[model samples]
Target: MSLRTVAVLLADQAAVFEFGVLHEVFGIDRTAQGVPAFDLRVCAEHPERPVNLLNGLSLNVPHGLEGLLGADLVAVPATELREFSPALLTALRDAHDAGAIVLSVCSGAFLLGAAGLLDGRECSAHWMNTVDLAAAYPLARVNGDVLFVDEGDIITSAGTAAGIDACLHLVRRELGATVATTIARRMVVPPQRDGGQRQFVDMPIPECTGDSLRDVLQWMSEHLETEQSVASLARRASMSERTFARRFVAEAGTTPAKWLVLQRVGRARELLEGSNLGIDQVASRSGFGSAALLRHHFTRTVGVPPSDYRRSFSRALSA
Candidate 1:
């Protein structure tokens, strides 16, 4: 069954970005992209009450808890970390019991945790909160590295932009890849990024020093179609191979080979979304060397093959 009705619960100190993420995904009209609009409603504890936001702004929510009664999906955006009232918790549980999908963005997982929906489920949240989430709910396995977790009816996402990925993933699963891709194109974001992709927070790269390899990085991006090796890169940066390797990790937050693969995948995604190039041509241009290699890495990284990606996202005019 497809999701049609969505209810986003509001609380005191709600985050504008996370709330906006939900609205951007399910609350807008996208008939131009061939995607159907959802019956979207925003709910708060008090109807017609002005709810305070984290940024000092306030929203006058028109719907109360009654708005959640028949929603096909119930979403909770990030809010201040605190326990919800018994009534709100019961509503969340009742919605899940009624077969509605339950979703949380960022620290909103804490609300689900409070509602006892996360017990014994593999879930996640923003990395900054994963430690506390795990400590509070030891039965729930909280993986901080992933962008989101989809445990059947319950889905949770990491901080900020990760909510977009999780929301689009649900759209793809329920609607179809065509709809998901079209919506993604309209939003001007990559159609999909696998949940397991790193949050890009493990290593912090400091601002460039005088000897930074900014020029070398730009050169590599431009020459991705050609071969790249540690020896060649070290020569271009005028450093020893060992020093280059060390500095590359210090500056880029990843090893050279891993960084190169990520860049290649990004380029391939652009070609798949915006160009009419065949699979082999895309592989050649993205520095994958062969279609088989591209398929292996792209599938591992994107959770889909190149042709399937193109079918989902290739523009109609280009196709």
Candidate 2:
């Protein structure tokens, strides 16, 4: 993959972060850092137009869709969902047909869907919209678990940050590991990422039929460090184990074990983000027993390893 030129296809209401990530990855003069510079241009369906962005921002795109059609890579940033014009959609299809790699960030996959590029292909989007995306394109396989899906020429990523991963992945695929690593280092991000969108999903409070099990749930949360099991929890709830299991599923919208693991992971995350505690101490306090077990659960649930997660989200970073 001899990637050089990158055309960012834009529309009104484009998300700032998604659009900026594309620019940061490919538009910057990174040759100083030994990474090949990309001939990147911002393109719109209408040339030399001011497209209103989300959050009261606006961008003057300098090129027309022809810039996208002739590029080695055509990138679609997150844009408001709507029916794309026949000309714009045709340009997208034409770019792919002419052997250009197509990439989308966050909701940008919706535009690819509208262009009929996702038919029978694996597509990933922000978890909140995966269902709508699948419903919209009946033939597309919408997978919400992964951070991104690389269907050879067409790559789709989930949410804003995942766009970085997808872009780095494309860079590594075409240029090599050294170039991707240099870019990641310059951006102060990891060259390779792990896990999936599921880890970033917020665990919503279960809307229960009643508050009968509220006390028990509260107790479980308060004592996350303590060893617990269905038998012990059932005793605390004053219900038989069988009945407790049934009620937990009804009220929590998930099994008790899954809920417990997620809760413990949340506690571990708090410690990792705000405390100077060791990984072993964090694991013990979060009821994971040992460091290995903690890593297994945390990595599976949160995408990155605990230490990496700490570095990315530590209070120091935020400050």
Local accuracy of candidate 2 as per-residue lDDT tens digits, 192-302: 775243527765645446587888888888898888899999999999999999999998888788888989999999999998889999999999999999999998887
The segments of candidate 1 whose C-alpha lies over 4 angstroms from its true place after superposition are 202-319
Q: How much lDDT does candidate 2 score?
A: 0.88
How many backbone clashes are present in model 2?
A: 0
Judge candidate 1 against the unseen true structure and give its global Cα lDDT, from 0 to 1.
0.87
For candidate 1, write residues 219-305 as lDDT tens digits: 988899989999999999999999999999888778888888878888998899898888899999999999999999988776668
TM-score of each: 0.66, 0.89
